[model samples]
Target: MIKHIVFWRLNDTAYGNNKQTNADILKEKILAMQPKIDGLIKIEAGFDFSGEKDSCDVVLYSEFTNKDALHRYQIHPDHLEIKKWLAEVR
Candidate 1:
């Protein structure tokens, strides 16, 4: 399996939502994707509670059967939607 990991840092207020709120919403969105996607061995998403300025607001950890599955997941329409929203927020 291949491991895919990502870290995100949101602006203090993005798309009219506060950082924590936006992170929470995004976390839920990401976690919800596991069941819909194919070839995913495992997936996890969460926010940092470390109270450190250098910490990323959110982190995603995923395992895929192969690189192709990872690639497919990256370009999947639903994934793209979230990625676009995240781009706007970041």
Candidate 2:
């Protein structure tokens, strides 16, 4: 199995949305991709409540059957959409 993890810190204000709000929306969009990608064993994302200065606003944890699955996921259209939106926010 292969695991893919990501951490994101949103801008205080971007695309007219607050950091927390954008985190929530982005979380939902990322979690929604689990069913659409092949070989994606599992995927989840959420906001951080730690409040630590070093803590990021959002986190993504995903598991795939193998390295190839992980590669496929990177270019998957659904994921690309989220990546594009995140670029605007970050």
Pick the TM-score winner: 2
User: Residue 41 error for model 2, in Å?
Assistant: 0.7
Instruction: Summarize candidate 2's per-residue lDDT along 1-90 as a digit string, tens digits.
Output: 999999898889888989988988998898889888899999999788989999998989999999999999999998899999999887
Give the worst 10-residue stretch by lDDT in candidate 1: 28-37
What clash count does candidate 1 reach? Answer: 0
Q: lDDT tens digits, residues 1-79, model 1? A: 9999999888889888899899888988888889888998888988899979899988999999999999889988889
Please list the C-alpha lDDT of all candidates, in the order they appear.
0.89, 0.91
The local distance difference test score of model 1 is 0.89
Maximum-lDDT candidate:
2
* Regions more than 4 Å wrong, model 1: none
Decoy 1 TM-score against native: 0.93
- Candidate 2 clashing pairs? none
